[model samples]
Target: MTIDRPRSALMAVLLAALPAGCTPVATVGPSRPPLAVRGSTATVEIAPVLLAARDHFPDGAEVRNGGIPNLVGAAPVEGLGGGGAADVATHAETQALRYSVAHPDIRIILTVTEGLYRIVARRSAGIASVADLKGKRIAAIPTTSSGYFLARMLASQGLGLDDVEVVRVSPIETMAKELADRKVDAVAIWEPHADNALRALGTDAIELSGTSIYRERFNLNSTAAALADPARRARIVRFVRAVLAATAAIERDPRPAQALVAATGGFTADEVGRSWPHLAFPATLPGDLVDLLVDEEAWLAAQEKRPARERGELAKLIDSSVLEEALAPPR
Candidate 1:
């Protein structure tokens, strides 16, 4: 049975879950209005690999594009089909899950990507480890997964956001430039951006890979309304299959995938190539997904002074049936 939470109730729950000293991060506004669905063609927010996979979809499945961040920010507002390539721990996904608590109109269905999230510090800054970030300026896009990864890495090193001066950068493309210009001592970011920063700084860059702290999961989240529609559901299933096939193709020969992502993502071929090794594409939810959510929830709760939710409550955020169906063998 699904629980339908009212928006106010959801906010209260989130507020109560905040850990002491954690200020609520400002909510992200959508880039535009949510995409309107037309017939069997569903609109989705996607990034990188999934965007590349759309070209491979068989007939009968049509997906319109929505801006990746806007997809998550707009889902509760307009109820679009789903948003892909969002980290499970990011505020966007967490907000979507909270919105789902009362609405039941949306749910996270699949994990499309996983990778090592890292912190790249300039050796010239006299930084050698995560602990060196103390009193230093760290650049990050606070609303995204990179921010969450930064928080986790810092916590692991017995530090917190308060320990360093945070330099907020937008467009993310500018992060590498900011680091190279000596505007920020380090950048805590995901692939492509991290690679871009390292490349810009050349031998001056020092990557502090906190692989033990973060195994980031990027997901494909869908609206329950979309899943409830027979035709849209079928199309979604096909879309998932296409994505899986793309994953295999990329795994087998990443050169083609690299070119695809480089073209679409605005990165050079060399940057994508450097970033590709750290990325893994998997179609199903991770077995430890709920555990990760629980831990992250607790951490967020502590930081925000909100009450931590029970594991079972967090588990309800995922609807794995769609993925299971996609993976199931035909009779």
Candidate 2:
């Protein structure tokens, strides 16, 4: 699928914004060839960072975007078809907090590195927490990670699927319509979709708040594929740098950044502007969270979802050195 932002515009805006300090010409060291990195949305939140890195490095660090969801599992667009490089993929934040005992080959990257936010359809009145949804009808699809987040949200309330009715729906647009029609009480979604949900339901119909389980339920993780490959790891580190840099730029002056985000998809500058304060464009992977992910893999193993071979070796699954290097002070 085509990216939301056109190549010409993205290049122009990012290039024009390149500060003197960020200019490649300023670097005195001998230049190296740009790295070639390919993967799913494992490191997507850092897109702007990667773009800036490409400009400064000028060695052609190419990041090919495809189905980010597929990086954790099969591509979402592929439709229930599981059997690809990413079928084993998982969301970074969520996987980082859970146990995935049976998948040693599973690797997680700090892609979209932010916590989960519950964005309800506009009609829900004064709904501020998961507790408000005690007996409400929520809409979402189980196949997606967003659905998993919703599940975790409910779990925090001492409730499960049995507690409330779940409607099988995919797009947040559909969920918003249903909520508008009084079909569902609320909708749980991630970025871009969260923006869409807000617009469709309007403030009158929806609500937004942090989830009950902050660090444990909703967090980041990546694929084992990135850890095992040296070339991929180095490239990922560079990509992380790019994202952090872009985030700093975006936060410092949002007009162009919002423009970039909108050009990529359905989000509006107003929505992105409002949501900016809530996003955590972190480049470091905390150690305890890594431990949580190991436990999550173990949990998955106990549930018989993970492959048997990966059960006891979850600790070796993470390689945070790349994140550490990215967070290091620039020379």
The C-alpha lDDT values of all candidates are 0.60, 0.50
Candidate 1 lDDT over 1-331, as tens digits, reads: 0011123443344434434522122122344221122110110112333333334453322223332333334442232224442211112344444444445455667777776778998999999988899989999865456677888888888998889888888756689999999999999977777888988999999999878887777666666666777766665665666567777776677665555344333345576677777776776788988888887777666655667779887887788888877777743
Worst 10 residues of 2 by lDDT: 79-88
lDDT of 2 by residue, 292-319 (tens): 5554444344444644334235545555
Off by over 4 Å in 1: 1-55, 60-104, 302-305
Error of 2 at 155 (Å): 2.7
| Native-referenced Cα lDDT, model 2 | 0.50
In the order shown, the candidates' Cα RMSDs to the true structure are 13.0, 6.5
Worst 10 residues of 1 by lDDT: 36-45
Quote model 1's TM-score. Answer: 0.74
Error of 1 at 20 (Å): 57
